[model samples]
Target: MANKRTPAASENDRLYGRALAVIRMRQGIPQQRAAERLGVTTQAWQNYEAGLRKSIFTVDGLSRLATALDVDPGLIEQVKGLLKEGVSEAWMSDGAQPLPTSGSEGKVVFFSRRAEPEVPPAEELAPVYGAVFAGKPGAIAFTPDRPDDWKPVHPNQRGYRDPFYLQVHGDSLSPRFEPGELAPAVRGVWPTRGQVCIIETHDGAMLLKYYERRDAQSVWVRELQPEPREFGVHLADIRAVHAVVGGAVS
Candidate 1:
């Protein structure tokens, strides 16, 4: 939950900002551009910052404000009643955060912090044996919020599910999948022939290849489409060829 701050209507918590945000977001209007339409300078519009405080405007101004905001004129009256009566903006909002963030292609945005999947609660997991050294086995439990620069358990390989995400680094496997693409190779389910499958060999090599298990003895991997005389078949124990991603939508 976020911190909630409600100001009296007479106070300078500057509820104007919230009003401005609502006005801009509700009407789908840009800031400076909306200011121009309202015949107010940009800085003057900035002074109407909404999140900080409660505010009041002239009845006539409120009428024009409602028109520009594309909201009911009575909304101003409602704001007055709620702000004066000490109701939090969040309360009237019906439990949604009021923050403006950016989206792809200059779209309005919101931030989300979702919890991890399949992780057991502290009560569900076994208790810790002891606070051991960093080098000790089983020293570190599940840490979902890993630091950005921290390397995974495997430097060259990746696992898609159950403690794995493939962060592709070098360009050796480029042309089909680009470098730096987080092409996570999960274990558990392998795809049918000619689909993207993250495979691990018996020799401890991890690879992203389109798989074709022609028979039980042969595995044909085509990272890139083949040309003439390109013998793409490699015979090996597939060890694990779990999970295909990005090849199909459903």
Candidate 2:
């Protein structure tokens, strides 16, 4: 059984709670959803965040949390050290830690410090945003929080100024793009004819379409799934267009 968190440990709990809050926020996961993922009640999750729950310090709790947050379980030790020793360089390397793999159902493979590698440069990493729709008009608001996951920058994406990745959520661009595929996209690079593009409109909406053609009045695009169709967004209303490079490699 896990030990109860005592009032004397309140400071440590508060500090740990803050770390949990940061990870949860970056993934854009709601408290309710996190609770569901961890097999706990929403109020339990809230208590965990308030430093009132010590159950999370147990082995099972840590495993569930690593899976729930979609981060490495090794991170728990880093966080534990933070609580016991105060601040250090843990946060600096937190973003690039590789995700944990499942050893079996409900079990996460933990890595030892001896097996870890030096932290790579931030530029070599690409932030993987949560699901983005491919067929419909939606909005993707960039948050100050870190992304849900990170991947090594793709070879083809190396030349771009700021390259990132997002998981496809819809199939409007089907065959060419299947749902759940992670695609690399880069800013400043304009999409050419027939290329897949991520477009942001002035109204703050985003769209994924094939670049068809553009004129002074409108920028046209094509969609494949459901039915083949073409549409145009007013040139003045278009905010930015990013090219989704070749699919994520390795």
Candidate 3:
């Protein structure tokens, strides 16, 4: 289903976009830099500035943007007022005002954190390297890629380094991650406690497990389904550990 936008909704989008653009430009914050700091894609940041999306109309979005741009909290209030109450005094004090909306103005969109995100187009799909065992010990060998091995990339993994997908093997992480689902992982990132990770060992063994902790000697990991258990893999035996951002059914 498509997201339908009313005339008022469209106007609100533009109004919020222009006001954010003004503050962002005044602060000399580059869109890419702001997006990187906010942990969003550059295109997502541009959408916020152009008012194409209402993802930034909430308190958390604004707070994060403020931190990214180093803008004062008062400016956030001014922007909110311009959108909600129309023609804020802060804008008037500067002898300029944001474009006025129609009398039948639509309320601003303040999406909850649980709001669904826009889907990525087919062109943005990542490749699935091979399978990683989520239950038993498995080899780290990657099979040859077929013509249809592509999978969707998560929004948060957009700027991650060397992103690739791996088909999950076994049901150890079931009810959350399952067999045959594609797991997106990135290189050069150390997995922290509570995160699922794709771990490669020195002996060509691959594991898909919850990261627990690590010390100079070994890294601890866990599994949930069938039974809950934790174990440690020696750091010297691990070749690489990449965080699994999320899983997608293939």
- CA deviation > 4 Å runs, candidate 3: 1-116, 143-148
User: Clashes in each model (backbone N, CA, C under 3 Å)?
Assistant: 14, 1, 0
Candidate 1 worst ten-residue window by lDDT: 127-136
On residues 1-250, what C-alpha lDDT tens digit does candidate 3 reach at each position?
9998633336766766666665665445678987897789999888886776676777777666766654434455556455555554344323121222223345432212234655777787777776777677754455434523776766545544466877877888886788877777766455534778878876667888888755435678899978999988886888888777665556
lDDT of 2 by residue, 1-250 (tens): 9997556447767766666765666445689998998789999888887777886866777666756765445555555544454443343234332222233353443333345334546658988865557665654443315588888876556534577777777788887778778777876455545667777677666677887655446778899989999998886888777777665333
Q: Whose lDDT is higher: candidate 1's or candidate 3's?
A: 3
- For model 3, the local distance difference test gives 0.65
| Candidate 3, run of 10 with poorest lDDT | 93-102
Candidate number achieving the greatest TM-score relative to the actual structure? 3
lDDT of 2 at 134: 69
Error at 122, model 3, angstroms: 3.0
| CA lDDT scores, all candidates in order | 0.42, 0.64, 0.65
Which tens-of-lDDT digit does each residue in 148-199 have in candidate 1?
3322332112112232444443333455455444443334443444455555
- The alpha-carbon lDDT assigned to residue 82 of candidate 3 equals 55
Candidate 2 at residue 64, lDDT? Answer: 68
In the order shown, the candidates' Cα RMSDs to the true structure are: 21.7, 16.8, 17.3
